[model samples]
Target: MAESTTQRTAGSAPKVQLSCEMCRQRKVKCDKLSPCTNCQRLGAVCIPVERARLPRGRFRKSKAAHRVPESDSADATDELKGRMERLEGLICTLMQDNGAAANTIVPAMADAGILPSPCNTESRSDLPWPVGNDVRDGGGLVAQKPSAYLGNSFWEGLMHVQNRPLRNLTDQRHDGATFAPYDILVHGLTGRALLSPLCSTTEPWATPQLQQHLCHVFLSQVDPVFKILHQPSLRAFLIEGKPYLHYDAHRPAPEALRCAVYYTAACSITEDQWPPAIGASRASIIARYQRETEAALVRAEFVTSDDLTVLQAFVLSLIGARSQDRSRRAWTMLSMAVRVAQALSLHVPDPPFLITAFEQEMRRRLWGAIGLLDVQASLDRASEPMILRSWLELHAPLNVSDDDIPFGHEIVPAESDSFTDSTFTLMISKAQCAVRSLTEPGSQYMHIRQACVADFQQTASQLLRNCQPDAVPFHWYTLQVADYIAASMQLIALRPLQRTPDFTPPHVSGSNLLRLSVDILQKTETLHSDPRGHPWRWFEGIFVPWHALAVAIAELCGCEDAALIERYWDTVEGAFERFGGLVADEKEGMLWKPMERLMGRARAKRDTLRVVFTPESASAQSQSPFLPVMTPDQNQHQRGMGLAITPCSSTSGSIGVEPWANVPTVWDEVDFGDVGIDQLSWTNYQDFMEDMQR
Candidate 1:
């Protein structure tokens, strides 16, 4: 195909004119080349926007001039081959210069079937992420239905536009000349890429002996916190080996299970527990295991399959999430697990025929556990529970042991009711009820919040009533700790009722809240002081009691009542000492930053009021106030949320511009001390509504 001789002679031969579309859109002058000046300056695509200027009445006088001469018509075909070659050469150069841009353009060339184009022809093959697909029918490693693409006319028009560059000095089109094509095609096509391979990096699979050992340790140590998996099935699966594999396309991958086991096991290990000759300490080893677990999950193709292992892995992943600083990622991952369980209708009883009674029971247990997690996550992050409150049909797990059901058994009938899970569900329902009723309250929430005190305590007491001497150590530990957790949760749930603007003299005022917090803390302290209490220091998330302690100390320091402050000061001091002591041995600042800051504030309080202590009280403590902790800083870069106040001087971590940040927010004096954050964030409030609606 030849360019029209008249058109070329009128524009290119004499003097170029007209600005490119890109320049016009950008409101700039264009050099008007195929790859024009403004596009070059901006590294953008340039296509000419045809001007509709007909030269006014110039057309009437130029009717003869518009006609092509015989010489130009005859010679038009002579330059056709040369022009075609030049155009082809320019295209090839652009393609090479912008190989990545070819990916965006390539989709237009071939169909989705042609993904990971044969033309990726680069020497490198190992890409960290997947490349886009190319045209193909159904036969391929992974099928792509198709892709949306701009037409060939659009591409051709963009790459090569009419209207030559104006050469006139006064013409704005004659400005600059350069062009660059930058492609974010990878990001655009990222949706189609399977991320499983990216999650492929994993630790070596553990030996059978190690796997068994870890499984035993995990069951004994971690299962009580989130009992999502069936112990009997897990034990048989680990011990009986080949019998456990699912005969289906979506069988649970061992790698994901391995991750779940290893991650749980990480919680139990300590520096002293690690074997000698291991250069790294316990924390490093645990972190390595966590990374491996994530990698294995990615490789397991968890998202595409309805595998039970993946759901359990997500639960374990959530346990690990609390260690992360203010991360919401776990909430998102937990939502996926909730969705998967709901999809399988674990919320309802398992269907009659497709699965055995054992599997049916297992599903029920997992579903209930998932609910507990969903509720907690929602409460912690101040998000609505993912499980639609009204649709929940989930029931309690059977109160039986793994030993109750031997391998190859269809199902084990419950001999007695297990209050552990059943009561847990009831209390969770109550807690959820407390949460929902509190959100943007009505008169009804008042009655409900008032009842939380008795309801939470009664339910908590019942939940712990099933323990026997012969029961597993971890099981007993979980029940005991749960009693404490429920007490703390009650305090959290009732906190909002302390501040009802519409109602006078709320159920729990600042004084009562302080008393309740101290009560919970004292109970936690007692349970913690017992022989098994050593593990309380190591427990993560809900079991940690940071909220209870934070409120207690804040109230203790800010309290106006001399009697309350005097009476609770020692407990507040003791709690602070315990937390501070825990973090003091670390090479790093602390395991959790919020704890560190809380401890710091506590010390500041003691220091600020050291003189107020009586001689008798002073004799029981150090004569001088605790020295103010100076946050070390090279440039004082340490910064994040959670701390209500911190040292000023953005460049300095120690000392402050003001005595306090915004003003000392005293507990009980402020709404936080009254209602707590859960009520404010609408998490605990949602739970209240869920409970009542139930």
Candidate 2:
């Protein structure tokens, strides 16, 4: 029986199943979670399945669910039809408005039209309307639709005038030989050109009559060329396709517009010719000239696309002529010149000339009003301080020659020297004073202040080391260094005082100590490797002695930022390790002998100890009060013991000791006021001390 049942099951066809719409479309197994996989993927609400009830009769199948009502089905079909009809109408309206043909509209609607045909095409054309179309023809397309043009006819007409010649004007009538007053008047009225002659160069020219005649020709003929070129419609047609329209067509090309402005200005000057007649002719010419000039000025001001150099030069000449006038007009002209110069500096290709011109004009105006001091003040306000600082830093090396040694009287003479030197010094002093003044406390400019501080610090340190003591006093150099230090301190203090606790500090940290240490470390490394002997190192003994002094001071002062101090220490320690051997032997008790004696010392019979010291004898004359002395034996012993016990004590406190206890002090007993002990005595003393200590 089991074999027979197996055979029957095997013979039966496999059962096929249909999935829920959600599950089948989603291609996921329908675990039938509250929403099936398909329903979840589709974001559709799933309906739960109900169990089917069995019929009472043997093996009777359950009936299927009932269908929708006939009337409801018919109504649904009718509603769908109505919506489709509305959509078709919308598409037709959009197509018509976009200037699509009726046939095109049908195809679009049949395919996938998104919008109805447009109701009006007047506002949609990218090209100008045909020239002959009537405005009143509502059904017919207008030939010259306003929508087709990007700009008004003014720009287009101007461009045409520039490109085309005047119909009846003769060469002689507007030539360079004789004045054509009538021609000049006509052209000026017609906006062809100004009434002045245009000269290409500043060299001497012909007589006034000839100049006037040339001016008339240029005004009557050449000036119109530029006007036509500036026309919006024409320029637009040239740049964009004939089918494309630009709203700013009248706007001039950057180069061409600039040239046109300059030329127009060139035509306005009344060089050798008499002024325009004072009746209607003059008034009309003046009004037209003013309008064109104003337009050109506006163009120069806002249109960054063009080079304004030539135009600026022309404007500058006009301002120069009227600068002495008492009227506001003169002031206006000067102001315009200033603005043009500034703009040209930024946008024009050749900035040097513009910068020179601006500097000259500004000096002229300022000197006339308030002298050099006020002019300097104005310059301070006008330019970025860093630019000036950078200029000085870059040019300083070039200014100093081999002949200009800091200490020598030849380079830096006494007050009684030649007037030229005095004048030079005075100028430099004045410039420095001006820069410093702008950087003083409460000044609105913080960048200038920072730059000034950095510059002063560098200069003061250099002068202190390289210059002779008699050349510039120690107090003066110290004062400058003190100023920088004070400024640095202020910068740090201001951060905490001026801002809320939540505010972050600016990029320039308040840790002057950290910056100073870093600077010293970098400078030391540079000096050690420098072939020429780092020039700044000449004053190491006079200025801050230890490269690590700044860091040490910072630490002593209880500066909150420890990381900066640690970084500085690391850099200094690294440098010490690298170059320490060159100066002294850390393992031995011997001091560094001069380089000349290195071979002799190496060949010496005894094992010698080396110590690194700055050598007080080399700082200045032996009698100099600033010279440093070797530590006395008793003091050295006490300091070594104290350091071993309390490493931190040396940084904070003093250890009292006598002069002759554990180590020999080389110069302790020598009376060197008149003539210090000989080098042999000092060396013998050191050697004896080392042997005794051992």
The number of the candidate with the highest lDDT is: 1
lDDT tens digits, residue span 1-694, model 2: 6445333421252433344545544455677566666677777877544222322342222211332434456765765554444444333323442343444535554444443334433343322111122221110112233232223332343343345432322243234355444334323333343312111122122123323433343333322211112223222332332321222323333322333333333344332232443222322433433433433333334223233333432343232222112222432234433454345443222346533332232222221221122222222122122223222222121112212223112233222222121122223333443343443344433444444444544443333232222233222222222333333333322221121223222232133323433434444443333323222222221112121322223232333323332334455446434433322222131322322132133223112211222244234323212111224543443321111111111111111122111111112222323232233322332333233223
Model 2: worst 10 consecutive residues (lDDT sum): 640-649
What lDDT score is found at residue 386 in candidate 1? 65
Off by over 4 Å in 2: 1-280, 297-303, 310-694
Show model 1 residue runs off by greater than 4 Å: 1-209, 245-252, 277-281, 323-326, 349-355, 388-394, 405-412, 418-444, 469-479, 497-512, 525-543, 561-567, 570-613, 616-694
Tell me the lDDT of model 2 at 83: 46
Per-residue error for 245 in candidate 1, Å, reads 5.4
lDDT for predicted candidate 1 compared with the true structure: 0.47
lDDT of 1 by residue, 403-448 (tens): 5644445755664445443343444454554444444345334355
